[model samples]
Target: MATVSMSVNGKLVSRDIDPRTLLVDFLREHLRLTGTHVGCDTTQCGCCTVHVDGKAMKSCTLLAIGLEGAQITTIEGLAKGQELHPMQAAFREHHGLQCGFCTPGMIMAAVDMVNRKGNHLDDQTIREELEGNICRCTGYHNIVKAIHSGAEAMGAAK
Candidate 1:
């Protein structure tokens, strides 16, 4: 087992895991951070998306040991002082979810999009950027609206 240390959900975490263990498995199984879902064994599903060093990344596509010392943020990290992040609030406000299985990843991706795109965002661009995130329940209409409105809300705070 390899010892890896990283910051998760604003907490410093260290664990001994297999070198080949995927970040998703480490988070879900070892760290008990089940907020990051596993939709497909393949990396195509954005359900395993998380923030590594403030950038959105697919946890399934990454090795746990490779992110040593990195600051990681999962859906559980989005809330601060019992307040939901703007993206999460937008998701709830816009009804961006249905079954809720994809909500975590969708929120993470939308947060990344808002942070990256800022106030200069468009519907088409948002849609194009969210291609990797698949939400089978909501038909994406509400998701796009959430992202657009979420971006505006976060930008306003900035």
Candidate 2:
């Protein structure tokens, strides 16, 4: 076991965990932040995506022990009080989710994309960028729309 210290969702946390524990497991099992899903243990699935130091990362691909002192943000951290984040609101408004299993990761990835790409994300670019995030339902039509609108909203918010 190794001692790991990190900031999660604006809260400072330190824990003793197995050296090989994945970030997703650390978040879900240790911190009880189950919002970060584990759709696939492999990095191919984006269901385990989260923001680490303002950048999107596959939590399953990183070991918790290797991320000491890093700042992580899960889907649960995106909202403030009762208000939803712009990307989340856009997804809800556009009906971007169907089964909802991938919603959290999708939202996190979209937020990070918009944050990096700014508000000019076109449909083609959005679709291309979201290739990593697979949604078995919805065919990604509404997801693209939501990202478009969400990108605009995010820019406006800033």
Candidate 3:
């Protein structure tokens, strides 16, 4: 086991974990942050996405030890107090999800995309960037709408 120290959801956390434990498992099983989901065994599914030092990352692709000294943000940390993050609210208002299994990671990825690209995201650009994620339902129409609406809401708030 390796002792790793990192910040999670704005809280400092240090724990002992097997070096092989994936960051997703560490967050869910250890920290009880179950919002992060794993929809595919392979990393192709964006369902396991998280923010590492403000950048989007597939949590399943990185080992817990590999995240040492990094600041990680999961879906649970995206809001402040009782307020919903614009992305989350937009998804809710736009009906962006179906089964909802992929919502958390999708929102995280969308937020990361907008944070990096802003409201100027074109449909093709959004589709290209979101290729890493797969949604079995909604045919991606609502997803794209949600991203755009979320971007608009975020822009308006700023």
Clash number by candidate, in order: 0, 0, 0
Better of 2 and 3 by TM-score: 2
**Each prediction's TM-score against the native?**
0.96, 0.98, 0.97
Say which candidate scores most in TM-score.
2
Question: Model 2, residue 119: displacement in angstroms?
Answer: 1.0
Backbone clashes in model 3, listed as residue pairs: none
The local distance difference test score of model 3 is 0.91
lDDT of 3 by residue, 89-156 (tens): 98999899999988998899999999999877888888888998889998898999899889889999
lDDT digits (tens) for residues 1-158 of candidate 2? 88999999999999999998999999999999999999988897799999999999999999999998999999999899899998999999999999999999899999988878889799999988897898999999999999999999988988
Best by lDDT: 2
What are the clashing pairs of model 1?
none
Which 10-residue window in model 2 sums to the lowest lDDT? 111-120
The residue-level lDDT of candidate 1 at 115 comes to 78
Alpha carbon lDDT of each predicted model: 0.90, 0.93, 0.91
